[model samples]
Target: MRRSRTGRRAGAALALTALTVPLTVAFSTTASATAASSCYAVRGPYQKQAEKFLGLRVDGRQSASDCRAIRAFQTSHGITPNIGYAGPVTWGVMRVVAQQQAAGHQPNRAHKCPTDRGRIACVDLTRQISWVQDGSKLVYGPVPVRTGRNGYETRTGAKRIYWRHLHHVSTLYHVAMPYSQFFDGGQAFHSISGSVWSAPGSHGCVNMRGKDAKKYWSLLKNGDDVYVYGRKPGT
Candidate 1:
C-alpha cells in the first residue's frame, strides 16, 4: 500500500508539471506578441510636421515606417544615437524647422550678413542649410546640409576657401570627397554619398548634396569666403 501511494504522488507531480509548462509558454508568447505590435507615439502635431518634411504619408500615427523616416531625418541632421524613436529632442528639432518653414524665415540669416564679401557660401548650422550669395543677392539655394558630428564639430567662424578639388579622396577615411573646397585646416566643404542624407555625419567638414556640390564647385572659386554660423540643434 505504501509503494502504491508513492507511485500515485509521483504521477500527480508529473501531470502538474505538464500543465504548467504550456501555461508558461502561452504567457510568454502573448507578451512577445504585444511587444512586437507596440508603437511609439508622437506628441502633438509633430507627426504631421515630420511626415510632411520627410515626404512620408501623413497618417497621424507613429508607425514603424514613420519611425524609420524620422530616424533617417535625425541621422541626416546629426542627431545622436539614431535610436529610430521620435522623442522630445527629435520633435523639438522638427517643430523648429516646421515653424521656420511656415513663417518663411531663413534661419541664421535674420542678422545682417557681411557686405564686404563678393561671393559667399553661408552655412546655417542651426537649420543645416547652405546657400551662396553674391553681395546680398541670393545666388544659390537654402539646400540641405550635413555638418560635423559631435567631438568633430565644424568650426563656426569666418573662413576663406583656399583650395578646390573636383575629384578628391580623403586620406584619413579613405572615402571619396568630390568637389572638395578646403577652408579651415583639414575641414572642407565637399559632396558626400547620398547615404549621408540618411546616416550620421562627417568628421569635420560641411557636406552637401551632389547637385548642390556641383553647383557650388561651379559658383565658388579659390579665395571665396565661407561663413559658417549658428549651432546645430540637439548637438
Candidate 2:
C-alpha cells in the first residue's frame, strides 16, 4: 500500500515539531559534538579560496589552525561533512557571503528589481539574497537565501503572492515547508529545517532561514508583488 501525501506531510510536521531548537542550531550543535578531534591535513581543491575567505593566510595549504576555523564555519553554517576541507561547496558559500556583505544596506543599489511597485519583495538570484521594500523604504531582510539548482533554476521576472500556508508541507517532497508563501507557481518562499547555505540549492523554491521566513509570513500577504532577478552561480 502506498502512503498518501497528506499522511507523509502529517508525519513530517510531527517530526519537525519535536525539535526543541531551530534546525540550524540543532544541526550545528550536533556536528560540532561529533567533529573529528584533529582537522584533516589534506588540501582541498579550493583551499586558498577558503583560506582567504576566512581571513587566514593564503598559503594554498591547509594548516591545523585553518582546518579548525573552517570546521567551525562549516558547523555553524550547516555545511555537511564539516571536515575542514576547503572544497567547492565551502568556497561557493564564501563567495555568496562576500556578495551579501557587499550588498549590505543597499541590496538594490543596482536597481535591478523594479521599485515602481509598492511593497515588493525583491530577490537577487545572483547575490542569493532577498529583501522586502515599500516603495523606497527598506522594510525587511537582505537575508541570505538558497535558490533553485541547475536544472530547476528559479523562474525570474515579476509575480504576486498568490497563496500562503503557514504550516505548509511539500506534497511532492513530503517535507515540512514551514511558513510557505507562494509567489510563482510551485515556487514559493519557505523555511527549511536546515541551513539556507546548503549546497546544490533548492528545487525551485526560495529557501530562507527560519526567522526570515517567519518574518516574511508576517510582512507579506496575498496580492503583494514579487520580483525575482539575476542568475544563480551554478545554473
Candidate 3:
C-alpha cells in the first residue's frame, strides 16, 4: 500500500508538470509578441508639435505608431540618431517645412529682402531660408538653408557675389564646398552633401541642397547682389 501510494503521488506530480509546461510556453509566446511590437516610449519634449506636424492624433503621448512615423521623417530628413524622439531639432526642421509651405509664391511678402536690387539672392537668416528674386519676381527657391552657427554667424546686410568656384574645397576645414559663390569675407553660398537641416549650421557659408546650389550656380554670376538679413535662432 505504501508503494502504490508513492506511485500515485509521482503520477500526480507529472500531471501538474504537463499542465505547467503549456502555460509557460503560452507566456513565452505572448512575451515574444509584445517584444516584437514594442518601440521606444520616452515622450519627447516636442511631442505634441511633432505629432501635429506629422498629422498624427496629437494627444502628446508617444506610441509605437508615433515612434515609427517620427523615425521615418527623421531618416528621410537625415536627422541623426533617428530613434523617433520628437526633439527640438526635429521640430525645428518641421517648422522650416511649414514656413516653406506657407511661403507659396510670396516668399518676400514680408519685404525683408530688398526688391530694388535686380536679380538678388535673398537670404533670410531668421527663417533659415534662401531664394532668388528679380524685382519682386520669384526667380528661384525659398528653400531651406543652413547658415552660420552662433559664433561664426553669417554676416548680415547687403553684399555682392565676388567670386565663384565650381568645385571648391575649403582650405580652412578641408571640406568640399561645391558650387561655391563667395559673397562675403570667407563666407559663400555652397552645396553640402549632408542635410541642410543639421544644426549648429555652417562655419560661415550659406549651405544649400545639391539641386538648389546647382540652380543658383546657373542663375547667379559674379557681381550679383546677395542680401542676408535677420538673426539665426540661438545665435
- Candidates in order, TM-scores: namely 0.63, 0.83, 0.82
lDDT of 3 at 121: 98
lDDT to native, each model: 0.75, 0.92, 0.91
Q: What is the lDDT, from 0 to 100, of the residue 203 in candidate 3? A: 92
Clashing pairs in 1: none
- Scored by lDDT, model 3 comes in at 0.91
What is the TM-score ranking, best to worst?
2, 3, 1
Select the stronger candidate by TM-score from 2 and 3: 2
Per-residue C-alpha lDDT of model 3 across residues 17-99, encoded as one tens digit per residue: 99999999999999988764455689899999999999999999999999999988888888876878899888988887787
User: What residue pairs clash in candidate 3, if any at all?
Assistant: none
lDDT of 2 by residue, 1-235 (tens): 9999999999999888777457878898888776655577899999988888889999998899999999998988888888899888888898998999899888998888787899999999999999999987889979999999999999999999999999988999999999999998899999988898898999999999999999999999999999999999999
- Model 1 global lDDT (CA atoms, 0 to 1): 0.75
